[model samples]
Target: MDKILEAVVMSSYPNNVKQGLVRRVIEAAKQPMDSEQCWSMLELSTKLYLLGDTKYKREIGKEVLEVYGHYHPEEFEEFFNVRFLLSLLQEGYGPLGKRSHYVLDYIQLGLQFVLESPSANSIFGLLRIEVLRKVCERPSPKQCAKISKLLIQHPQCIPVGKHQVLFCQQLIRCIRQFQCVSEGEEDIMEFLEQVNKVSGLLQRIWRTQTSVILPSLKELFTIISSTETRNDLMYLVFLVTNIFIAGAHPCLAEEQEAPSNALASVVQFVPLELMDGVIRNLTNDDSITDVQMMTAIGR
Candidate 1:
C-alpha cells in the first residue's frame, strides 16, 4: 500500500502538490514514530529526493539521514544510496545543518565500498583520493584521529598506485594540521605508532615508485616542522630520519649509487638544527646498525 501511494504521488501529482506533501511529511516526521511508521516515513523521505529540484533534494536527504540516525541501518549502502550520500557529503554537508553530523560515518562507508570493489584501480581509486582529500582540507580533531587509525590499522587495504602516494600525503597533512602529541606517555606513544605506520607505508611506496614518492617527503618534513613540543619534535625527526634512511638504502647492487643520491635529496629538506637531533636519536637507538648510521649521516 505504501509503495502504491509512492507510485501514485510520483506519477499523478503536480510538482507543487508533491512539494507540499513532502514538506508536510518532513514536518510530521519530527514527531515520535514507531518502527513501522518510521520505515514508511523513511521510504517516503528517500523518494522525495527524486521529486523536486535542489531545494527539495537537500530537504529529502536530511530527512533520510535523520531516519538513518534513528535506526542505524545495518546495510547502510543498501538502505540509502552511496552515490547520493556522497553528493550530499560533497555539496550539502554544510547546508544540511545538523544532518551533517554523520559525515564521518558516510565517509567510512564510501571508502569501504570503494576499497572492497574489484575496480579500485579505476574510478574508485580516484573517488577514494577525493574523499580523503576532502577530509584533509577541513580536518577536525576527531576526523584526524579516525583517519590516522584507519591508515595505521589497514595500510594493506589501500590498493597500490599513485593514489597510495596521494593518500599518504593527505594523511600526513591531516596529522600535521590537526594532531598534537600530548604530554601523556600514552598519547606520545600512539602518535609514534601512527607515524611508524605512515613512514613504513611511505618506505614501501618509495621502494616501488621511488620517483613518485618525492612529493610525499615534503609532507613528512611538514610533520616535523609542525611539532609543538620538544619531545614530539625529537620523536618526529627520529622517525622521519629512519624513513629517509630506509628509502636511501640500496636493495640491489645495481642501485648503490642511486641510494646516496636519494638520501641527499631527502636530507636537503630536514631542518638544519634538527640534523643534530636526528643523528643523536639514530645513535641512541641501539637497533640501528653502524652501516645504516653511516648511510644516514655520511650521505
Candidate 2:
C-alpha cells in the first residue's frame, strides 16, 4: 500500500520532477500489471478516484471508455485505471463478451473492496464519492442500483453526509436521463426502488441536515413524483408515502393543488415535529397543502 501510495503521491523521479500520482497512475494504467500488483494499483486508483484535479494530472489510458475519464478530467481517470486492472486478468474460460462482463464484475468487486477498507473513514470519502459519481454517469440500471444501495447502507464509510446526498442526486439525475413514463406505474416503481436504496441514506442525512438535503430532494423528488406529465392525484399518494416511509421530508415543488384526501391519508400518521424542519426548509414550496401545515401544527 505504501509503495503504491508513493508511486501515486510521491515523485518517482529525481529533482522533485513534475511526475507524481497523476503521472504514475497514468503510467501504471497504460500497461497491465501482475495480478497481485494490478489489484493493488486498482485499489490505489480507487483511493485516488475521488480526488480533484491535481496541478499536473494527465489523461487516462486509451483502452478505457471515454465516459469514465470525461467527468472531471484527471480525478475520474482512476475509473479508467480500475478498468485497466480488470483487463489484465488472464482469461481462461470466457468468450469475448463474457470477458467484458467479468471486467465489469471485477470493477464492482474492487469498489466493494475499497468501501470496506478500515481506513475508509480517514481517506476513502473522496474515492467513494468519485466512484459514485462515475457509477451514476453510465452504468447499467442494475449496476447503478446495486452500487447506490451499497453506498446508502455504508453511510459511515462515506463520512460526509453531503457527499452521500451528492451520490444520491447524481444517480437520480443519471436515471432521469433515460426515458421513463412520467409518473406512470413503471416510473413510480423505479424511482421508489431508488428511494429504497437511499432510505438509510436519508435517515442518516436528512433530519439533522434539512438545509443541506432539501434542495437536492426538491429537484429529485419533484422529478420522481411530479414529472411534466404527472397530472394524477394517486401518484402523489405513493410518492409521499415513499418519502415518509424512508423518513425523508415530503417536499413536492410540483404539487400545485392541495393534496387529495388520498394523499393526506398516506401521511396522516407522521408526527408534525418530525416534519417541521422540512417544512421550514421548503419556504418556497407553496405546493405544500394547507392540510399539511395544519397537520404538523396540530401536533
Candidate 3:
C-alpha cells in the first residue's frame, strides 16, 4: 500500500514525471488486493478524477468499477468500505441549470452494474441507495424518477425503514419537478399513475415513519392537487387517501399522531367533495371503530 501511495505521490511531480511509476500504479490497481491496497488505488483514482481530463477520469472510473466487481457480492461488505467509495464519488453540485454529466454517468454506470449483477442482496441495494441519494442532491428529475422506480421494483433490493423513506423523499422531489405542459402531458400523466400504483408501498413506509415522511407527503398533496385536469386530480386523490388510511388503521393507532399533522397539511389542497369522499370511505370501513372514525373526522 505504501509503495502504491509513494508511486502516486511521485507521479504528482511536475514535468519530470515518472511515467514508469504511473503505468505500474495502474497495473497494480487492476489486480485483486487487500482493503488497504484498494483504498490506495481509490485515492489515486480520485486524483485522476480531479485532473478533469475526460480520458483519464473515465479510465479510472472503469478501472474502479471493474475492481469492485471482482469481489463477490456476498463478501462485498467485508472487502470494500462503502464510506470510502462514497467519499471518492462526491462531486460538488454545479450551478442551477448546469449538469455534472461525467459524475452522473459514472454513478449510473456503477448503479447499472449493481442492478444487473446476479446478487440482489441487501448490501448491493444499500449501496445503490447511497448512490441514488447522492444523485438526489443535484438531480435530473425525470432520470432520477426513472431510476427510483427501477430500484423500487427490484425484488429484495431496497431495505425498508430509513432507506425507503429517504428514497420516497427524493421520488417526491423528482415528481414535483414536472411542468405538466401539454407537450409532455402523456408522459407526465403516465409518471403520475406509476407513482399512484406505489401508494400502498409508500403508505406502509409512512405508517412506520410518519414524522419523517410528513413533509414529502404534504408535497405530494400539493402536486396532486395542482393537476390541470379534474380527472387527473381525482385519480391522485385515491393515492393520497390510500396512504393516509394505512396509518389510520386501528392497529396503527400509536402511529396516528404525526399522520394527523400531515392531514392538517392536506386540508389546504383537498377539495370539499374529495374530503367528503375520503370521510365516507373511512366511515364505511367496518374495521374502523366509532372512536377511530370520530377521531379521523375531527382531524
Candidate 4:
C-alpha cells in the first residue's frame, strides 16, 4: 500500500510538481501506516525540498521526524538523519569533483548528529571514523584535530575487528606522510598528534581478544621499531602501549592476578626473533628509555 502511494508521489505531475510532490507525502505521513512506511514517507518529503534555502523542506522534515520519533524515536531519527545527510553529500559534489562547502556543512551536521545520539556500539563510530578519514585525506589540520579528538573519546570509536586493521593502516600512512612532509617545529607537533592517534588506537586493543589486529599491528611495530626510524616515533609507540596497559606501573603484584596482562598480550603477539632484534637495536642506539615501558615488560 505504501509503495503504491509512494509511486504516486514519485510519478510526474503536470503542474505545480514540487508542491504536489510534497503535499502528497505530507498527506501520506498523516495516514495510518507501519513504522517503516511512516519513516520512508518522511524521507521522501525531505528529498523533495531539503536543498531549498527556505524552511519549506525543513518544516516538513521536522514533522516527519517527530512523527517517526513517536514510534522508535532515537534509532529512527538517527538512521534517517544519517541517510539524509549522506544524500546531501552525494548531491553537493561539484562539477570538478572538489568537495563543496555545502557538503562540508552536511558532513559536520551529520557528525554532530552522531555525537549527540546514543551509539549502536561501534556502528556509529565506524561512520564517524569514515567521516574523519575523509576529512583527514583532505588534510585540514584544525578539523582533523577536532574530529580525531572527539572520536578518541567516543567509546564506540574503538578500533576492533576490521576497523583495528584499518586504523593501523591509516596511522602508518599518516606516519609516512609525516616523515615526508614535516620539518622543524611542525614536525614535532605533527609527530605528537600521530603519537596521540596511536594511543587512541591503543584503547581499542584491550577489548579486542582475538589476534585480528596483529598483522597490521606488526607492520606498525616494524616501522616504529626499526633503528633507522626517528626516535620520537619509537618512543611514541612505546608510550602509547604503556599508557594502554591494564595496571598501574607501581603495583606489579596487584596486576599479576589476571592471566591476561596487557604487556604479556603484546609480548605474545610480537614474534620472538623480531623482539630480540628490536631490543638489540635499542641497546646500540642513544634513544631515551621509557621507564614505564620496562615495568610493562617486567609485568
Which residue runs does candidate 3 get wrong by more than 4 Å?
Answer: 1-37, 46-51, 71-79, 85-139, 146-170, 180-222, 226-299
Q: Quote the positional error of residue 180 for candidate 2 in Å.
A: 8.6
Residue pairs with colliding backbones in model 1 are none
- Local distance difference test, candidate 1: 0.46
lDDT of each: 0.46, 0.42, 0.45, 0.44
TM-score of 4: 0.37
Evaluated against the true structure, the overall lDDT of model 3 is 0.45
Candidate 1: which stretches are off by over 4 Å? 1-80, 91-102, 106-126, 135-138, 148-163, 178-212, 218-299
Q: What's the CA error at residue 280 for candidate 1, in Å?
A: 20
lDDT of 2 by residue, 1-299 (tens): 32644454545454246344445545445553444554454444433332213422212212122222332233333333433443333331133332233333334444433443343343344446444555455554344455545455554434355665676556445444432224566655664454344344444455556554555555444553442443333344454555455543232323434222112222333336746765566555778556544443332
**What local lDDT does model 2 show for residue 239?**
47
lDDT ranking from best candidate downward: 1, 3, 4, 2
Query: Which has the greatest lDDT?
Result: 1
Which ten residues in a row are the worst by lDDT in model 1? 250-259
Q: What TM-score does model 3 achieve against the real structure?
A: 0.39
